[model samples]
Target: MAHAGTVSKHPEGFEDYVKRAKLSMPPEELQGELDYWRSRKVLQRMLDGGLITPDEFHKIDELNRKTFSPKLARLMA
Candidate 1:
């Protein structure tokens, strides 16, 4: 079973995308994107449970955005 609110838009995309990115994309950037999403999920949970404020979430999110410099995912944006 999948986790809540995190279903893939293109279910088959994961294998192909990750394979391609691993073969072609910079490892650190790809790793950063992966880590950001992982952190985002935990952060979201904290927000939902009122462990953190919206301001705190947005602030850290902004920092993640800058620190990650996400690129490949922008293709879907």
Candidate 2:
């Protein structure tokens, strides 16, 4: 269960939050943001094209979180 996907637009200001959070971060943290977004872009493209199943996308999303969290933690520190 690992397919690519995009984050649908959220009306709860998540996009703004992500932007602001990235700007407020230190250099290392900003790099983490870059990495996260780059990976996300790949997923987004697949999703936008109606390419992945929900279960597969969910699994990939979970993997993304797991893969990036520790890296972000190190950057934040």
Candidate 3:
């Protein structure tokens, strides 16, 4: 049954929510999310300023796919 303010047919109970939050990212992983956005901004600026060609930017994107750990990628996704 749904809890107050929750629409899920089988709303996760409070304990489940607490456990899921506890299993979520550690401080380091949070920091990595910040770093990813920062680096993405830099890449975007480079593209905007014409400092890097589209092809070059794409190459860097490809590199990022390889560089960011799969776990980080999944978290970001």
Candidate 4:
């Protein structure tokens, strides 16, 4: 079930989270937000062009949210 770009099967522990947090500073978080918004634009285009269903778009959006972990994204979107 693992794909090339997929997350690892092993669960991340607290230390992992802390290390990741340290690495992903505010700048990285901002970049993640920017990336999320850019993706939303593409996703919107796909939906508008009838390339993807609304349900499918939403599913991708949810995945993007999890992938980016953008703050305030849930509130805004």
lDDT of 3 by residue, 1-77 (tens): 32333323222242343254455665454444444444555787999999999899878866765664323444323
For every candidate, C-alpha RMSD to the true structure in Å: 8.3, 10.0, 12.9, 10.8
Model 1, 1-77: lDDT tens digits are 33433433333344465565555555555565565565566778999999999999889877877876755444333
Candidate ordering by lDDT (highest first): 4, 1, 2, 3
**If both were scored by lDDT, which would come out higher, candidate 1 or candidate 2?**
1
lDDT for predicted candidate 4 compared with the true structure: 0.65
Q: TM-scores of the models, in the given order?
A: 0.58, 0.51, 0.52, 0.64
How many residue pairs clash per model?
Answer: 0, 0, 0, 0
lDDT of 2 by residue, 1-77 (tens): 22233333333433454654454544444444445555566776787888987676667866866776524333322
lDDT of 4 by residue, 11-55 (tens): 323234335444444555655655666678789899999999999
- Those runs of model 3 whose alpha carbons end farther than 4 Å from true positions after fitting are 1-24, 70-77
Error of 3 at 28 (Å): 1.2
Model 3 clash pairs?
Answer: none
Name the lDDT value of residue 9 in candidate 2: 34
**How displaced is residue 21 in candidate 1, in Å?**
10
lDDT of each: 0.62, 0.53, 0.52, 0.65
